[model samples]
Target: MASSALQVFGFTLGVLAWVGMIGTCASPEWRKNSHGQTLIDNTLKYEGLWVSCTAFVTGQTNCKDYAEFFVNLPQVLQICRALMISSIGTGFVAIIITVLGMKCVGLGSSNHIVKARIALLGGLLFGISGVLTGAAVSYYAQGVLQDYYNPSFAQGLTNVP
Candidate 1:
């Protein structure tokens, strides 16, 4: 009974993780920059895998989707996009497999050993998805940091005098 309860808990957590991953991937505020109240204006900027947006203090926001051509995007953006998409895909597969393997689910073979192996494989896929997500976020953050510290980069509104 205790093992069944644990399995349920684990399955719940896995589903929540998958949902969180989707939210993170879809959010437009992955990276944010705020310009202090300058004489000209105060604005907030956000950049994400799919779009860039600006918010004005007057409660107005404007967003623009990325170019249709993937090749035109920066290398870091390209790699991160691929990794995040792959992670989502893997997580989806993991969810299906986990449901089949769960102790409470009767969709698959009744053999205990086979079910255990399937559960293990599902767990492994979840781990792989997590690793992919981490790599993508870390790589993107590294690129952002490198550009932020480089005086010569001269990109983004943050560099405005």
Candidate 2:
């Protein structure tokens, strides 16, 4: 079960890498236009999250560091979660921006932006679903990390009681 979970998380991490690369690979010329600019910005934003994730999974750094800085307070953790969630949103924005940019180029007539929109929307949906599922698996892995630093605390009520 745990292996399966880790696989899911790893898969998520891979998708994030792909998104980051796509965003990076997008043309700089696209940035000249406002619409294209938005897509590039959003894509890079998601890229940042994936970069962070890569660092964490590699044991170089982890979100827990940020979470700890906030003392894991709801207020601070909220910010952390927001960052993670926004990564998903950023991916969607990239897709939308890319599709819109494509449409602006006159990719097709009649169908026009419809197909572009649909393609981007579909990609976003798939990306988001992957991120959501990955988050669940990653959350479980957190226990192993917590145990390493403070075994007693993670063991159960003994840490608090």
Candidate 3:
């Protein structure tokens, strides 16, 4: 009984994580620029993998999508985008595998050991998806920080929102 309960809980959490990954990939505000802005400026700049946006104090927002060509983007952005997309795909596959292997679903083999191994494989895929997400976010953040702190870099041009 306890094992069944644990499996349900794990499945719930895994599904939640997969949904969160999808949301993250679709969100357009991964990084924001609000430093040293006065009320007069009244503009907030933010960007994500696919779009850049500016929010005005007047409650207006304008966004622009990235270049159409994949090869035209910067190396860091290209890598981050690839990683996030891959993470989402992997998470989706993991969810399907996990559901099939779940005790309550029992879609295939009835043997406990086989089902357990399948579940384990799904869990590993989830782990890999998480790692990909982390790597992408961390790498992008590192680039943002480097640009933010660089003396030679133009502050006004950092966030293209």
Best prediction by TM-score: 1
Q: Model-by-model lDDT, in order? A: 0.82, 0.41, 0.83
- Which parts of model 1 have CA positions greater than 4 angstroms off? 154-161
Residue-wise lDDT of candidate 1 within 1-161, one digit each (tens)?
23778878887888898888888888887787757779334788888888888888888999999875468787877888899999999999999998888888998989888888888888899889989999988998898787778767654444421
What TM-score should be assigned to candidate 1?
0.90
Task: State TM-scores per candidate.
Answer: 0.90, 0.28, 0.89
- The residue-by-residue lDDT of candidate 3 on 67-152, one tens digit each, is 65468787887898899999999999998898777777859789888888888888899999999999998998898888878766
Q: How well does candidate 2 score on lDDT at residue 114?
A: 67
* Candidate 2 structure quality by residue, lDDT tens digits, 1-161: 12335534543554575476345333122111112344333222111212222122223533212224334343423443454455556555644444443433344333644654544554565566456535633552353344446856435544210
Error of 2 at 134 (Å): 10
RMSD of each: 3.0, 19.3, 2.3
Q: For residue 56, what is the lDDT in candidate 3?
A: 84
Clashing pairs in 3: none
Ten-residue region with minimum lDDT total, candidate 1: 152-161
Of 1 and 3, the candidate ahead on TM-score is 1
Q: What is the lDDT of candidate 2?
A: 0.41
Task: Name every residue pair that clashes in candidate 1.
Answer: none
Candidate 3 segments exceeding 4 Å error: 35-41, 155-161
Q: For model 1, how many clashes?
A: 0
